[model samples]
Target: MKSSDKRKKRLPKPLLSDMEEIEMDVLSLEEKISYISESLFNTDDLKIRELTFNNKKMVILFIDSVIDNRNLQLNVIKPIIEKSAGDIQNVVNSNNVKETVYLDEALCAMVDGHCLLLMEDSDVLTYICIPKVMRDRSEPINEKVIRGSHQSFTENITENIHLIRERISTPMLTVKYSSLGKTSKTKYAVVYLSHLTNPEIVKTIEERISYINVDSVQSPGYFEEFLEDSSFSPFPQYINTERPDRVAGNLMEGRVALVMEGSPTVLLLPVTFFSFFQSTEDYNNRSLIGSFIRFIRLISFIATLCLPAFYIAVISYNYEIIPVEIIFSIKSSLEYVPFPPLIEAAIMQFTLELLREAAVRLPNPVAQTIGVVGGLVIGTAVVEANLVSNTMLIVVAITAISSFVIPSNEMSTSVRILGFPLMILAALFGVFGIVIGLMFLLIHMVNLKSLGHNYLYPLAPLDLNALKDTFVRLPIWLMKERTKDLKPQYMWKMTNPRGWKKNEESK
Candidate 1:
């Protein structure tokens, strides 16, 4: 055989039969995709269909209900089958006349709520975009708001994108598409403004995502696990929000958003400590009310964290610091109690925890019933038994209520859990122990970084501009610049809400 002929021909193995011979050659796209889909999407629910259009074969694959099949039939199937003789003849006359063509682009377009058209003898597939009718609904439960827009993200990526696009209409708003999950090949998008977003942040995020190797990722939880800067920290680095307005506001402020398919919650990067205490209602109200509410929440946060520990320390070791009347009152209250103050505090704390857990496990009505019954039964029983004093009950109740004052559920839970440790320390070493715990907390928080940005920004790093909006929302007119730490190109989003002429007229 000639050299070219020999290179094309494969040598036969003596032990293997012709039927079992392995071919060392490049596989077609269809064959490769067939192998991958069969191996990866090996489930009863997964649907894959091969249909012919104008004598050209194309494969349609998607998870059921994840796509609207009715729309696909009308837009894609009808378009190809109803084509006249001229259209069929044109593709046949063109280059690369194969009887069947696989259009990957068309498949991707269809995945994004479009219909794909694969023609015979054509490498290019046409994407006939179809507008999917999504079920209009209120905002997601976890992210519900009393004052903001109620449109929540859907399972549909297209609808989610539409929600974001509607809020941020600027051309600078950009979306970069990518896929993860080696087996599922689920599509995800990293959205941010080009001019406003820091290039280094984008690069770091892209690199982190590109390196993810997993079988399948179901929701934002998987993405969070993959992208979190520190796995050990109780404090969340990425802010997860289901509200589009929140996401839009962050994007405008120069933060990036990672939106995944099949997940309503979007992951926000570079969050600071103060952001946790904020709610969407903060901005919707008047400045005076907003600032007051913000201040109250900050105070509540500190109170919740330190109250139990401080109380424990005062009664256990710092009784000398207490006033004579208060000391006499506290002593009288503890006289009937059998246990020490620490033991009493522990009993009350554990009882409250058990009640909270039981309530959460029950249904809404049942949970309410459980809370009332548990509270009444436990509170009465404890005081009657003299295991914990009535005064201690009030303090524990106030502490629990204060914990809930934090708007973010995750932060509240962390604070609740962390309180136990501080309470223990205070009981052992008194006021000095509480101070030590606070110092440690401050150091840890100041050293923390969320996606490479300081977690305690505007306070630890001390940015005057960011402080205007962090602890308090200054009036729109008084605030001219976007957050400086965000590195936004347009520092001045709007010149004072009151125009220059209005200011002059007032003067």
Candidate 2:
């Protein structure tokens, strides 16, 4: 055989063969019970009760932790015992009642919080839904807004869907469900508007998700990492949010949302770099104020990415660029420090990151205390000990605050991480190195894709119509079309939302 053929033969198979198909068995009641007990290793929580009704032996099986005891008693047991019905399905007041002869299917239903009923001399088994636990729908703690609905998504997928359905209330909205994770069987939903969303984008998302070969999907983060277009890029191609209003807004704009059963965070797909800086509160406020805040966010993005590098360049090799008065003060402060500009910046930035992580991990009250006290104590001690210059301290402080200005925490973290490389380049080649680093960064972003769509849309692709809503919030009437980059099915959102002005002018 050729060497290439040998290499091809060494590759692993494409599909998993771990989950074997089990055939259904036509067994007696005692044999069925024995099979379930053996399959589950006779666990303690697997409660199987035998009851006599109309000279028939009926068996009930369920896991204690996931079942509603009262419902099982009143709906299934009470009706069967009191009514003495031949058909147990008629007496049960449950919505999800089904008959199956497969032991694997019956076991799967019982594991999913359903109660199973088997009668002697009968070839069928019945299962009813009796799930007991659910989390309460509460306001999002992370993505709070001053002027919007307070509700957020919960761990329950059905409740999360209800939250979105309540907001949109349109027949065009559709949700498709599928299971992921071979071992966990984690369920997730792909939701979008059938008439508004691009069909190609939906198909791509579905295919990517369907092809994920994993043993478990513990959270939405797993899906985000697996479904993203580029794994090497630091930037997050998909936007994850806990706010239902934000998901609803994106759905209306012809984007797809992935909501998982066990995760509160919903993933919004085909997002651009600019999408991370947007806030739902932007549209909640006046257009002018919203535009101003967005502009500040954009400035913060630049400052967070380049401030440390710019500081390093100026202090290390381009002191001439700084004003004479400011340069004297900076020089005087640095004269007492023993480390080079690069070392000082690295030390201070690392310390700032440590404090940030510490504050996040601590309790709210303790975190507030640590944030204020730790910064004051550590910053003062370092400066007084001549470890870092005061100017570098101020630069690091400003850079840290600018990173926090970003609306998305994941993007904020990526921006902060991107600064480290830029600072290193600045140390090596001064301003020239900074420029080269920025060029490489720009090239990477230009080439990146979010679900096969440009990552730097409206800026790289140069869509003038979309620019109105990119860096600034134009009046609602002015943004008459959806984002052109997504290739939405319906482009014109409103022909003329401000048509009243034309009538008034003509009169």
Candidate 3:
């Protein structure tokens, strides 16, 4: 038999199923094209257009729903057929064009909206970049701020990078792209400032991303789970945000951000427990006002986590802690409640959570209606029915509102969920149980790490300098250096804006 015939005979019979193991050199053009078609077997939108180029057979493959047809017609087909360009490199007008001899690599490129060009009797396949459809950038729907850039990230990774680049146009900004998911081949970018960011942190993040071996990474949340220090913890180790300005701000602080394709949420790493409480609005407002609001958010954090438990302790075992008049008022309200304080608080809190979830899944107008109607109707019904006490309702309502004040939704939800365990503790051992639960929580947080950095920085290790910006938003000029916990290469953000005073004294 001829050598060519022997090579064709060696090719795998189940081409699509065994394509990963099949060598590109052993397959003929006919077999390769057949394999491509069979691999995308059930996809009806897969388009394979065969045409003549330089009087030779050529084929282009792409998904009809994703590729820009205009570019394919004008830039690709027009140049190849009319200009008689011999190679795809000379014809296609794409920013990214690559030749791949591996079927797996070619398949990935084609799936990511790249047009694949295959020529007769050629072992190489060329991939032409054709941009996919993406939503326009708009103001963040969830992470809105009173003052800051209105732009948020979109589903497109390139567009998100463009938004970041527009803000930080320096050469120090570095973006590295990688593909995750063996089957899905989801693309993501790791961005950081080369000079300002710690090299070891960048290396650690890159290494962790490289080690993420999974069948699919659907979103930044999925990726974060794989990289997180503790999977079982309810608290989020990384801060996830939709606002580009937030990501940019974090990046400027020597932190790294993970931007995934097809996901609007970006993950900011090496974040602290206090970081979730801080908002872009804090910087937008004046120092005194910002500090006041920051203090309120911190107070809300404690209230969300401990308020229900504290109430359970007070009403069940420590009623003496209440003032004389307050005790009478509470006693009067609880006289009608048939259940124990624990059960009453649990019932009210669960109802609040149900209403919250329902409102989120409904339309805006309908959601608003549900929030107002659900609160009034449920609160009144429960209290009148003696299913819960008025005091319990107020406690649950206050806890819910406090949780909502947290800037990070993930942290807020975690805080709300945490109340359940604390309530259980408070019921079992009263105030003592609450104190023990809190101590355990504090220990866990101190031990937790975000990207190998402490999760409760400045507070756990006790860095007084960093503490200046943690609970309170000090004046920007006072914060002359970045957080030392992050170990940034360059710590000083500013020298002194009021340097004229020092010069005057010297003269």
Candidate 4:
């Protein structure tokens, strides 16, 4: 059998080191091309070929789909195929090849999705670029916008990076790629503005990522384990966003962004509680409308947790607080109910949660059907069955809706889980139990720190200046300070762009 045919029979070694010895054994250019082609063919869609120029033979190889076909046809294949001699001068000018003996420099062209052509006696390789397959369009699940770009991120990491780069074309934007997951070998990149981001924070993040030893790092969330200060805490240390605008805004604010392979979400480091509540929609709309919606979100948060417990405690134990007419109406509502206050409330909460879980798991059309039917049937049947008081049912329904008001799903889940403890305490010790539980929760929040920054910043640490942007996002111009409570050494951000503006005449 021919050497080329024999080489094609064997599989390519997975490691780069194995290829070096094999390359030496394959004396002929055809044998080398055959070996490389055979090795990587099954794993990747590789294009391989052998070219003859005068007496010298050159082998060319590349991942076919990854490179731009036009560039390869016009710049590489045509030049080599049309050449008539071993005259290095003619090949160099005709092919636009910069080097005749540097293999590493020639291979650098492959990083841009190009293929390389290697010759006998010549160290240089010809690089042919081509295009790659792309995933079909899918609506963005995380960064949904009613107005603005409809294009969402894909599972492909390169495609996601392309989407980001297309938006921010600034020269200062930088991307540093790294690998995690010892076995999975998942690729991820740290993107930030070199001039805008803090050097200390970047160094800290890079150092932390380098030490990560895991089975696999598939998503941005998986990388969080290395970056986060407190894992056991309920709060998320990194802000996961899908919107390029939000990532760009955060990058401009001295924060670094992480994009991992297969994960559509971008992770922003050193995030705050105030940031978790913010949605891109808030900024997309008018400032007045945005502030109004934010205020409602804050109100809903307070209501979702404490409202149901307060209602139960007030009606069952603190009847004196209710007016005579209101007390009579409440008593009448519970008259037909057979279950006690606590049991009735539990039944309602449990039923609502079950319905919610079912709706989420089912198909959208079916989920909507289930929601409508479940609400009508359960609400009427429970009341008619004398299972729960009408007033308590209304309170439970309102509380459930309020929980959804939280912008972050993690925060919403935390709020729901935390509610049960408050509800149990309210049932056992009237209003006093609620107060004690709340006091404990307050202490936990105050003590909680995400990435060494207080979770309840400006509220617990008492940074009065930070408050203007915390509970309320003061107008851009009025905000004149940085959130440097983390004692960040590089405390320079264009926080108040207009503050330092000199008079027009001074310019």
Off by over 4 Å in 3: 1-135, 502-507
Q: Determine the backbone clash count of candidate 3.
A: 0
**What TM-score do all the candidates reach, one by one?**
0.73, 0.74, 0.74, 0.71
Candidate 2: where is the Cα deviation over 4 Å? 1-135, 502-507
User: lDDT by residue for model 4 over 299-329, one digit each (tens)?
Assistant: 8888888988887788667778778998888
Clashing pairs for predicted structure model 1, backbone only: 139-150
Count the clashes in each prediction: 1, 0, 0, 9
Candidate 4: pairs in clash: 12-39, 67-129, 67-130, 67-131, 68-129, 68-130, 68-131, 69-130, 117-126
The sequence of per-residue lDDT tens digits that candidate 2 reaches over residues 7-90 is 110111111112355333356678878877765545444688888876888899986645777889988888888887666767
Between candidates 2 and 3, the lDDT winner: 2
Instruction: Give residue 318's lDDT in candidate 4 (0 to 100).
Output: 76
Error of 1 at 283 (Å): 0.9
Residue 502's lDDT within candidate 4 is 57
What is the per-residue lDDT of model 1 for residues 191-252, given as tens digits with 9 covering 90 to 100?
88776777788888988888888998888778877887777777777787888888888887
- What is the Å distance of residue 330 in model 1 from its true position? 1.9
Model 3 poorest ten-residue lDDT run: 6-15
- Predicted structure 1, TM vs. truth: 0.73
**Candidates, ranked, lDDT:** 2, 3, 1, 4
